[model samples]
Target: MSDTDKKTVIVFTDGACSGNPGPGGWGALLQWNGQEKEITGGAPDTTNNRMEMRAVIEALNALNQPCHVKIHSDSALIVNAFKQGWVDGWLKRGWKKTNKKPVENRDLWEEMLTAMQPHDVEWIKVKGHSDNERNNRVDRLAVEASRKFQQS
Candidate 1:
């Protein structure tokens, strides 16, 4: 199928972690053709970046068919990775960073890219904690999901 034949999906995503490597959560709101689906999840031990990456991956995975996806995320880590060709460079360089350190969350990055394979994806960076209602709501969803672990 061609890109023009695919459904256009708009998504908002966010992630939160209580501590740098503490409990974390990811949230995504996907909308298409006047319908909306919200997805959220938590991890007992994880990092914010992982959760951020997961949000995009999970949302894309939820789609049953190929789509033209527009993802709005507050995470520059994920957005810039794609927009700046970091992922391509890393793939070419054997998944190692410029400093020769193994890239963190390589597993998730691989899975995310695999899930993204069937879609036309555009990553848009949004300001965190700003005026976007969808972003703010997803942020709350992630925070609340993480807080569930905190209270347990």
Candidate 2:
């Protein structure tokens, strides 16, 4: 297959927070054929979930156009939400859980959905703090980004 026909992008992402609701950071690595990109950012006050979602958001947004994407993340909340059809159900219920409680990060979820709309995405769960090189790299990137805020 030629490069044009090979439009799949592979990504690995991780999020870290010093405290549940304290400074947080997100890291993402995107690989497409011969090209690779690493992206990271931090927030003064944010939850781990938000950072996790942000890693995906940033990665998807980095794409220049629609393409098939395989996303690897260590967050079960995110991986399960999509793989288990929870996200679909949430959208069907107007972003409410089965108990009718509003989603905690509706804005981020909505953003993720929008970022994902133009692409075919597959969410893959990776073991966190494991020996996976890319996962470990992103995890360190996230922690380093988060600690930047702690030092400030």
The model with the greatest lDDT is: 1
TM-scores, all candidates, are: 0.97, 0.93
| Model 2 bad stretches (over 4 Å) | 1-6
Clashing pairs in 1: none
- Which candidate wins on TM-score? 1
Each model's lDDT comes to: 0.94, 0.92
